[model samples]
Target: MLEIGGVSVEDHLWGGRIMVDLPLACWVILLLEYLDTFRLEVELIWPAKWGLVKLLYVLDRFLPFVILPFVGFYNITANPSSDFCRILFAIPCMGIIACIFIAEAILYLRVFALSGRSRTILVVILINGIVVVATCCALLARYIALATWDIPRPPGVSGCKGTFTDGKLVMIGYGTTLYSGILVAVLCVYFGIRLYWSRRPGRIITIFYRDGTMYFIALSVMSITNVVIAANLPTGFRFLMAPFQGVLTSSLSIRMVLRLRQGAREDMGLTTVKVPDIEFTPETSGIAMDVPRTRLGA
Candidate 1:
């Protein structure tokens, strides 16, 4: 039996040798709840897009919650062997993977909309998704194989298997994570350069100041966190995935809220086109008129 934070892994057995923790189950539920809340808000304000994309995001946000609990309960009641438990766990893991891809899709769409460019962003997202999916599949397959073959469980846990030991899976996951991090960095640099080059003399402020920098920064931070988690891939990494996913989803929902609020402000004629200390030049061709500020209420 293994212990983590006073929780015992004694009773649980998977594949005739591995033990699963109750805390991990609880953590998954909490993450699902957070994602559900965020998804509800996003659904209310999701931008008009192709029908299939909309459908996918809706399913991505809701399906995990619906599926995970059933699998968890089934595993708990059945007390299945490690092989069976690993198979059951694959369901939720795949669901989470789907959600991550959905998030990447949303980000790609938003970038395309903002830049008015097509195909490039879509291709990038597609490539990233393929890599991520392939990596996850390899990981799941290896895990199942190991459990079925009765490989010795990692030390300190009777029946717990290491999910990140597969080198191909590790490389794939880390590659995607690193790619995301680099993409975010590039975007930030591009925006910063745009902001600098567009400075106009004498003009204190311009509507371009309202670009959604907060949203960009939030995404960048989340991407960096994902990279870190992927790089580490420690035994506890899975536990951190849910919370980071929740935060990322929440940030996206917040951006949606800000967009709606900006629209309302425009309708009410409360949006000033000028700011006292900012300026814009003709070179600022692609700057958004609705730049989201930290103090949006002001």
Candidate 2:
């Protein structure tokens, strides 16, 4: 039994197992969600015309497979060279950024549509995205550059853990994501409230606010939890929430898109049309007549 500092080497290996477990859990979620939602994608997305929304959906839906493998490798592979760890770490982080960008783009598009396709709102979304991407990139770059890793995991344990100059810095990069979600939430509420007061909000409008509110709240809670834990907890556990939060963000973002597309199809397909004077039909009350003027999807 070997001991490093007062802790047994086995205890240190346990930490490596935890890192593997976190990402492994995320792998389960990713697969389950894909199988669960594939039918919906076929019904809603596959037949639809090629457009920005579909592209974003396709990327967000499939990107995880590409990213998660690297993440898994980083955690489960036996002690790897420091150079290899840096490369593996960079790949997953870049993949995460790309996937997140795609998801956020979907949300931004919904917000843009709700704003009646306002150019001003478009500019705001662009600026917000630029800020978020730049901030996260800078922080990520700084941490990777300053990170150091010389210690090797015990023979039985597996991981490519890098000791950060300040582990909290990595979590800080994640916390920056909250800024994007908050701005989107604010835009949603601002435009959403106006629409609510001005008229009987249509199905599309309701979906925009509904999905927006839920998505923002979920991400906000997850981000804050990550930041809090990272700030207060030991550096080893700093990334305890990353996989959980990442899976959640992807899941919520994709659901929002699917719901909107479904709403658009429902409103447009005229499943039940209501005519005031010429009433009396089947057992249906007829679909409401206040659907948004613009198409709800890209």
Candidate 3:
């Protein structure tokens, strides 16, 4: 049994091929949704908060769209030289790593802020994040190194075809999946409880609650789908769903920051989420005059 993408080459010869265009369509829709949101992001959010985290946030916005075309193009093109293959593979690989970590960072910051910036909570989350990222990186490196250079071309397929060289890459893939899934799931629960009990929701918190929940659920489903498909399906079918993973995670990451900033600008009382400043009117006597201030009260 000869396998180029973990599927027996015999399967390709027998006319077995998964519908790769489905994921392409999925990504196209996701990218369109992302682009629709981009204008609001630039106008309402990008101006005020410019930092490393924000940079990551922006990258998360655009990386999935960038990656989708590359992956799709590679799928249709003819086989390339070994060096070219490595370069082609490296682009999406690096994008995936960046997206995961950047999205994770944005999430950690959200949780940290929501937790009232507790040092202990931040430390614990950071420690766990570091371990997950490091382990997954090592696993991915090994998977790529061990991958077969030539991916078998399926019958009737117009373009190049390939997948991970080793099945063990599925382990690393889902490891990262579970890591992000658990973290987002926890945030969803924590905030759900918070949103449930609070009598009055701050504007930013309300936006966070709605968007975060949606993001959490969508990403969780995608990650689980990735795991199930990669582990149990034929190898050709496995890689087809890969690109959509970043779509929501990236969209939500950027949307989180944008919504937060939008909330802050629209609601004067909610500025403390990112930056906190307290203002006081001149005091005539012993008492401070009317002061405009914002603080985390809940």
Candidate 4:
């Protein structure tokens, strides 16, 4: 029985295991949903938006199956100080951070795709990306250092240990927590406004913005949870961190699947998930597409 800050490792691990299973189940369900969406997109939804949505959906499906399980399995199976396990675990954590960055970058591009090219939008995206990347890098560095220094294994923990005296790691963890919190808040506000405005005028914007907001919010919450876990919990309790990451990734994947399904439904007119597919014909090259009604009420 590992003990961290008076919490039993068995209890924590049990909870983590339960939570981790949620994502595994969710991933399978969402993968099927993604395939359905892919077929619909190819059959109905317009090419450009459908293609982008499909790509993101694929990433979502790939991560839970290909990336997350590896990390979780390694964490559970490998003994502490196993060089292979440590490297494997670190690679995926870094991959998670990288995936988040890619998601954010794609969000900006999706917005641009919807709103048309604008210098201001480009600037905003660049700035946000820089800040988020830097924050992730700091967190990664701290995680690596802690894992590498081989902090004293707290009683009952089953895997790699963390540094006890490393102020740097603590600081990095805290910084990551604070930075992620701030970033999420900003994104929420930004997307919230877009969602609101899109609704007020009943614009036919891609469902990407609405769904992206939800995804980011989930990610932000997970990041905050991780930061809190890292900062307050003992090293043995670190295993609990896996669930938060897993949940976040799973939530993102779900959102992608939902977006695809919604897009398909809208294309089929089965529901109100309408996203305008504006065509630029020679006769109406500059004419804007008719905005569809927002489904805010639904």
**lDDT, each prediction:** 0.45, 0.71, 0.61, 0.51
lDDT over C-alpha atoms for residue 236 of model 3: 53
Give the winner by lDDT: 2
Clashes of each: 15, 0, 1, 1
lDDT of 4 by residue, 46-113 (tens): 33365555566446545555655655555454355646656755766666665555555445554544
The estimated TM-scores of all candidates read: 0.54, 0.84, 0.74, 0.60
Candidate 1 lDDT over residue span 155-272, tens digit each? 4443223333433453455356446635644653564455445554111112222333444555556556655664665433433443345335433533443344334444333434
For model 3, the stretches where C-alpha displacement exceeds 4 angstroms are 1-27, 150-166, 191-199, 269-298
Model 1 gets an lDDT of 0.45
Per-residue error at 17 for model 1, in Å? 17
Candidate 3 achieves a global lDDT of 0.61
Q: TM-score of the candidate numbered 2?
A: 0.84
Quick one: best TM-score, which candidate? Answer: 2
Clashes in model 3: which pairs?
76-159
Per-residue CA lDDT of candidate 2, range 28-77, in tens?
A: 99999989888767766775667687788888888877777787787667
Model 4 TM-score (2 dp) = 0.60
- Cα error of candidate 4 at position 204, Å: 3.9
Q: Per-residue lDDT of 160-268 in model 3, one digit per residue for the tens?
A: 4444554557656665766666776686567446534544555665676677777767777877787777778765565545566666677677777766665554444
Off by over 4 Å in 1: 1-53, 67-75, 149-175, 188-247, 250-298
> With candidate 4 superimposed using the best TM-score fit, by how many Å does residue 13's alpha carbon deviate from the native?
8.3
